[model samples]
Target: MSKSYKKHPYLKESSQHTKYGKKFANRKVRKSEETLQHKDYKKQYCSWEISEYKFYMSEQEVINEFFASRNEEYHWMKKFKTLKEALTWWKKTYLRK
Candidate 1:
C-alpha cells in the first residue's frame, strides 16, 4: 500500500520519521499495536472517534455532579465520601494485577 503523508501529515522533521512524514517500524519509534488506519479499515467508517478519550468529569472534582440526576438508588457510590476514594477503590479492585 502507498503510505503517503495524507494520513500523518505532521510528523516532526527528524530521523524518527521519513522525509515525506511516513513513520516506520523501529526500535526507537514505538509502534502502536492498534493504529487508527487499521481500525478505520475494519469498521469501514468514513470517520472515527476514540470515545474513551472523552472526559466529562474534572480532575479532583466532586462525584455529586455526575450523579445529580441519578437518585439514591445508586447506593453503590455512597460508600465513598469523595471521587478520589471511589477511584482508588475501583483501581485497586479492577486494575490491580
Candidate 2:
C-alpha cells in the first residue's frame, strides 16, 4: 500500500516570488495602520465644546454679526491695551453667563 496526498493547485510554495502578492499585502498593512492612527487622533481631540455653532448665515454675515455684537456689548474695551484684553473682557462679560 502507498500513502497518497491531495495537492492544491491554488497554493503557492512561497510568497517571495509573488511580487504582486507582496505589494498587495504591503498596501493592506499600510491602510490598516493609517486607519488605526486616524481613529486614535480623533478620539484624542473629540470634544463637544469644539462643535460648530448652530447658526444659519454666510461667513461674511457671521463675521459682521460678531464684530457688531462685540462693539455694542464692549465698546469700552476698545480702549484696552491689547486686543487680547478686549477679547478677555468680552468673554467674561457675555459668554460666561
Best by lDDT: 2
Model 1: lDDT to the true structure: 0.40
Candidate 1 structure quality by residue, lDDT tens digits, 1-97: 6422222221122443333322222211344354555344434322233122222222233355435524665665676766677766544433332
Reference-based TM-score of each model: 0.28, 0.22
Q: What lDDT score goes with residue 11 in model 1?
A: 19
* True-structure RMSD for candidate 1: 17.4
* Model 2 segments more than 4 A misplaced: 1-75
Residue 24 lDDT (model 2): 54
Q: Return the top candidate by TM-score.
A: 1
Whole-model lDDT per candidate = 0.40, 0.43
Q: Please provide, for model 2 over 20-97, each residue's C-alpha lDDT reduced to its tens digit, 9 standing for 90 to 100.
A: 544554455556544555446444333332322232333344345455656575654346555456555444433333
- Prediction RMSDs, each to the true structure: 17.4, 27.6
Candidate 2 global lDDT = 0.43
Which 10 consecutive positions of candidate 1 have the poorest summed lDDT? 4-13
